[model samples]
Target chain A: MSPKGPAPSSVVREFIKDIVVDNRFCFSFPAETSALNKSVASFGVINPVWIVKSQDNRKTIVSGFRRYNAARKAGLETIPALTFKAGREYDLFIAHVAENTAVRKLNVGEISRVIFCANEHFGHGFEKISDRLFDALGLERSRKIYDMLLAVAGYGPAAKDIVSAGMSLKAAYRLARFEPDQRETLCKWIMDNRYGTSKSSLMIDMIDDIQAVKKKSVDEIIADAEAHVSPDMEKPQRSSRLFESVATMRNPILARMRRDFQTALESLNLPPSVEVIPPNNFEGRHIEFVIRARDRSSAISSFKALSKVAEAESENTESSKLSGLFGWI
Target chain B: MSFPGFSKILIAEEAVSTPLTKKAKAAWPDIAPQIVRNLADHELQLDMEPDPVAAGKRTLALGPNRGKFIRKCPGTMGLVCCNYWVIDLVEGCPIDCSYCILQGYLTDRRIRLATNINDLVDEIDAELAGGTQPVRVGTGELSDSLILDPQLGLAETLIDIFRTRPRATLELKTKTANIDSLLNLEPADNIVIGWSVNTPAIISSDERGASNLHDRLAAARQIVKHGWKVAFHFDPLVLHDRWEEGYRRVVDDIFSVAPPEKVAWISLGAFRFHPSLKQVIRDRFPMSDILNSEFVLCPDNKMRYVKPERLKLFRTLKNAIVAKAPSTPLYLCMEGIEIWESVFGGSPRGDKNLCQVFG
Candidate 1:
């Protein structure tokens, strides 16, 4: 292909079967096609997909793979596409990535694909291309991010899907450090439970602690009855319970402290209007007393009641016990 | 130090024509200096890179120490703080330790070498004159005191200032063997030169660009030969396989080089960092096994080894040091009173006792 103007007006109508969906260009976990199909059916593809002709006289969709799939599903016989002269492979990859990124923010899986595809086409000198590629793709220009995205791309398609769903880039990078089967099981569990980004991160830490400290296999840890998901609970409830159980098992001392705090609070047996709140993680010296009093008189009465309760509790409880409850130990 | 050293030197315009800036320019005569309007301009130039670590390595910024140069060490709340005073002459360190808290503590990576040494000296003199109680003052809290000492010669100036003061001691702490500038100076009873030492394995693996364990001990030996009190900090002590043997070797190396009475104090602190430093470590040093160990978030919001693990490491190391030099005072840095009591059978409780140990 000879050099031409930068922006070529080469829109053409091509048969649906003639356009190929390159796996490199398509998102691993695409959005639902029905909505796009409905839109294309009603509005008739407003924007033409970008494409490049191959040596075999076939066209490859550089961008808009989702739109092509949606158009095909909508029973359209043909679609509009703007073909660019196939220049250097690097340029083609950049154009494809730029078009897709311009359309919407790329997810973790798509970002991984772009990085790997760029590397394959550009032939390894990441130091030269990382800054430019990151800038063009609207990614943080960091070697750390580049390395992580590459590792995330190394995962199988299923794991990539899980990452695209909601798992954070950091969590995916951490999971990539594990063995393939372990990584898959962990990712699948996270996906099945619909764990949000933060929960997924916590889950990863829990698994890491279990493997490192307890010397248990990821499979064994997940298969334990303590981690078993209750059938009657909703997804959020199941995830919350599983997270709590994992945290409790991971830090038994902390769990014991929390349990002791609860026991201490219950032993006080304060009225509902007067509540005692322990510090976060029971790691502070002060316990807050929150009293819901209606007026000044009520406030005075609540304070008097609190004083009485404190005196009685002090008389009953040893200083060491109270100090331990307050994290003085 | 791995990267190219300081491609461009940026001097604050406000600091132009000052003696410190002139000294900085003279220190590196080969590299022409560029005078920016202010430190803000220098920072703006640094912000151009998306990731500034590399750029920061190649750029050097010299500015006045606008903030209070002499301030209390912001020790973690609820922990037994040893009321140490800090003299921050620099903002960042050149030697990169994988587990360094400065990686997260500093906002930028540029080596902000403060050229306003006169103001720092004035502040310290004022602080010492105001109080009769002896105070332990150090310059290694923000950056290593001697990494750039060959160029700036701040150590000599600081030593000269502290030698005359009766109520304060100047502690020059470092991980490098950059003590050539201070070897020939007059020995001050109040001046203590401290070295941050770790196991040989950790020195090779994590402490990039720092002097190795052998060289640091040799440097301490040189300082002690001059009748200057020396201290050692086994800070951020990492636990690895055969760690006991590794740490035992370090303790033995310390006693072999420096005499027991000449040693001022030995401080032990296990690896601890803010929670955010965990990700930074993983990103920067992927192969480091430091984070793989068990860590719990303490009340101060820093991640540390759990109580039992910390107690075990401290007690073992303490016993080793005591066996070698029973008279040398040992203290724990930034540790809770409970751990202190567990390890030492009592707590320092306040700064007065801690200062008295050194006194």
Candidate 2:
């Protein structure tokens, strides 16, 4: 069967106070009104609010909560509104949700609120409500993605904004589990520095793992990172160094072994064409040496240079330093 | 038994007459068996529950095997195989270790009793009838062999089949000390009672429902005295603080009671798992620190400690085991040939007996 649209309503002017303003069904983030106050004061309620009659024939406001709230602050006596016939409260809630979903450029906070309240207002199963809202948002059907989005409706203001600005779920999952103060500090720092998703994600992952391992607070970790980074360094370089520090903090032994390997590799100072590469995390037994020679003769020359190094006294060689990598557990 | 049995028993209408069903009904008398027309429909409801794995552990279903009962073990891809065969006697184990792969693999969490053990025995009897080489068949691959043996007496039937076959060895691996029925039975060969052992910390932390280290070793000692061969599996060697001392103590305790001649084999496997199981473990065991360690994707697509750390852990434990008992045969489970060589000083193929099963 084809789906039916909401019932029709007529526009009329009603006293802002007389219209029993019950907004439990409204789909929105926690109400903040600076922007709405400025817009309503300038535009003078360009569009009418939507309302319906309650059980006892009292009019109830359905949508345009921000506009009505702003009008109250602006000291308006009567507000223009669309009055639907009685007993269409649920229908009006869904229609307003659809209109908001289709028309508004919603932030993640707004999107999450819409999804959360739509399920609540309609009393539908979370799965069904989430499916409709995810379709409205044009998101992929990932497991628990809808649930996580719904959970965002409860986050602090800064965290919601960070998610709105495009932090990946991969990063947000870690950030969600952090203590509220830690989450807010990281979110506030991300907002203040205007770190994009990739940088924000790396910050969450590295810092979370480091603090878990070192038993350090986020404040101390951040302070340590900033103090160690030179003041004159650029923001990107600072971030890079901060990440390295946390990486080292999470795996101290591996980090030290990696430094020793690099130093030993540098001491050899092989021919230009020959480059030594350590296995990822020094986990494997083999150390790869790539020869990027320009021609056959250069390749032969690079091989001869390596042979010369091998011919040197075994004590002078750095092969023993390579063994140090395996010693770390 | 240290573990609580099933909360509810689900029996297929046709399978209600099976001896295993009657045994489960008798064991948990408070939980009356509900005749189910379609077990799959009931299992799907488990997916909708908040915790399907936990729900499956509490529910027991007795039914016929929809397919053959015996199959080759699906060893990790790109890793060495032990050529182990498995019997799906029970589809799930009650000993719910936090890192058990069954949590992710068994979508239907119900402890499905393969009620048609008669058919399973007959099928195994045919498979082992003609083989000259010893075929290592085990019921513990998918489910513990003795978790229900106190009530079901399932091991005796399998022992009857394996004891008569000269070329077959049956392993009843478990984390529980439920070996009462096995002790009274006639002494038999080609039957190894294996226990999956871990340190005290791991046992208390992760393996909440299984037997403790002392109890498991005591059970092994009991079986050893009965003239039955015993095996020890230190599989999934989880890395933890002071793990070296913990594992060394376990090895010392095992040798102090279990003679090396009674040992069928000792296999060492480092903790490794599919990446997807990480979240399951985290959610089920919120306080567990296992997932906090540094892991990398190995060639088999399973997340494991980096190769160097694995080598270090294996070498440390190998030295401890050798110091206590050098003559006992040792092999690496689901590891590369290089790891086998590094841990045992040679590949599985290098030893004549190891070549039969682990080559």
Candidate 3:
């Protein structure tokens, strides 16, 4: 490579270094010559070009791909250049990541994959990254970058390309949250780009919400999400172990008290001034639950039912959860 | 209503002192038993007398003298009927505004008391039918109009009634942050949302239980955003030690959320009250700075700043208002013809009537 070293200042050439092209870099010039010829004719290159030198002393284009192409079209042979720093392959990969990450408009998913590759190449959790570098890069930017990397690593390869191509991070994260079998149904839909960012965003919000539900088993959570997304989808195949656990859950105390509450609500014979909606079990938009009564008198009667339920439940746990549930707070 | 009736109340009160029923003991916890016992006694006495003399329907027991509608403006002040109407939405206010007459007149300190709203709306329907002239009506006098509205759905109910009535314009004046129920309802222009606002310092100390100035203006901004015209009242403008800074902050904050066009009118009235109110205010608000000031009695027998003090405070506040919203019409709530001319150089008479003044 002619003892490859930093270009001497006296060289008659450009000063910039070549930009490495890989899956990591998303934006690029067309790989053609006609457009380059048109560009060099219109305006001289505003900045110096960069190129990688091949073994045996031949210079290869590394950075400034567009300028290199234009210079070639204009019949320029010797382009300006700076030498790439010698380092391990992974170190070079990280250098590429650092460069692309600093670009303002870099897509979050692409940055995520670069970080993922770097993390796989280097061993460290994202949180362990230096705070100084994080602050300089920006917390939100780094967070997004780490979140994308976590997503691709968490979801396998096919999903990674779909996400890196402009799908919302939240949707990708949600799809990754699913079991491999459940996620298979979405693979075709995502790769085809049939789902827009908004729909995927909604799915992501719904997934996070469903995953947070307490007292509901995995089957119940999946069932609820399926009910919302596509009602026509048949129930997923469940083994006997999951079914046995669900069937074994029993709270006769709560059941008996709930029945009593319903009886009280019915007997109140409330005036038309009052309207009652029975207590519902499903997750609601705001309130987790609502116990309806026909009138103020019946509502009071329902409180008695609540008292009984609370007393019975407390007999088992001796905790104040039931009392707090009744607005004791 | 009689002294023996009070003795009978003592006997009934004693009856409730007995241990609560097993039902009550089981349903309620330790304090609930006591509450239930007391509730039983109160309910018995309330049933025996069902109607108190003070509880009956009455209107316009207190307010400034009324002027003919046509003399001030081309049309009647109210949107539906010719004349003014009373909206007894609630009878008592828990919020302690410095200028509130409740400190003077009210004997109770209860919250969430209703004003027989069902009956009030019926009476309003009858009065608006009394004349072809539109009746300008408002509540907020007996109590804050929207303080209990969210829980009671009172705003929704009132808006429902007024939406259908073209001649009746109901003004809901409040200094509360309770506005969620009202925002969802389609309040017609016939309804003007009013806010009684003062400086944050006044709100923090004097107006106990009322929302702060920012919250009040935010509620007003929300009402305006939802297409309701708003009004501001600087009534009972107490000249506390830091009155100027307090008033300027209030004026600046109000303009942040609202513009001149969104405001229907701004009413300014120096703190004036009947002499008897001073003792009641002292007893109720022991720490009130409002009662610490010097005042003189006018011919109306109400206390106000001596003419010069009133002029100075009014001029300074008027400047702030003009600076914030130059185009909004400003009026004196209960000032006389001379005081009106002295401050704003005009009265709620002549070609400039209250309706046109609002526009």
Best by lDDT: 1
Candidate 2 error regions (>4 Å): A1-6, A10-152, A165-171, A190-203, A271-275, A293-329, B1-3, B122-131, B356-359
lDDT of 3 by residue, B1-359 (tens): 21001111111222232322222222222223222223222322121121211121111111111222111222212111112345554555645555676544543322213323455556666666756666667777767888656434567777888888877677788888788987887768788888988877767878876888878888888888888888899877878767999888888888888888888778787888887665445434656667554455555567676555676778888999998888787776655555566677765554254655433
Candidate 3, TM-score of its B chain: 0.74
C-alpha lDDT of all candidate models, in order: 0.77, 0.77, 0.53
Give the range where candidate 2 chain A is weakest over 10 consecutive residues by summed lDDT: A320-329
Q: In model 1, what lDDT does residue A289 have?
A: 78
Winning model by TM-score: 2
- Model 2 iRMSD vs. native: 4.1
Candidate 3 Cα outliers beyond 4 Å, as residue runs:
A1-329, B1-84, B107-116, B351-359
Question: DockQ of candidates 1 onward, in order?
Answer: 0.18, 0.21, 0.00
Candidate 1 local Cα displacement, residue B238, angstroms: 4.3
TM-score of 1: 0.78
Tens digits of lDDT, candidate 2, A1-329: 75575565677888988977765565565465688899888777878988776667788888888888889888888899888777655556667777776776666666666666666656666666646556666555543565666666667878877776665554565676678888888788766666677877767766776666567888888787667778787877766776677667666666777887777766666788887776566544467789998899998999998887666635665655444434432
TM-score of each: 0.78, 0.82, 0.41
The CA root-mean-square deviation of candidate 3, after full C-alpha superposition on the true structure, stands at: 30.3
iRMSD, model 3, in Å = 35.0
Candidate with more favorable, higher DockQ: 1 or 3: 1
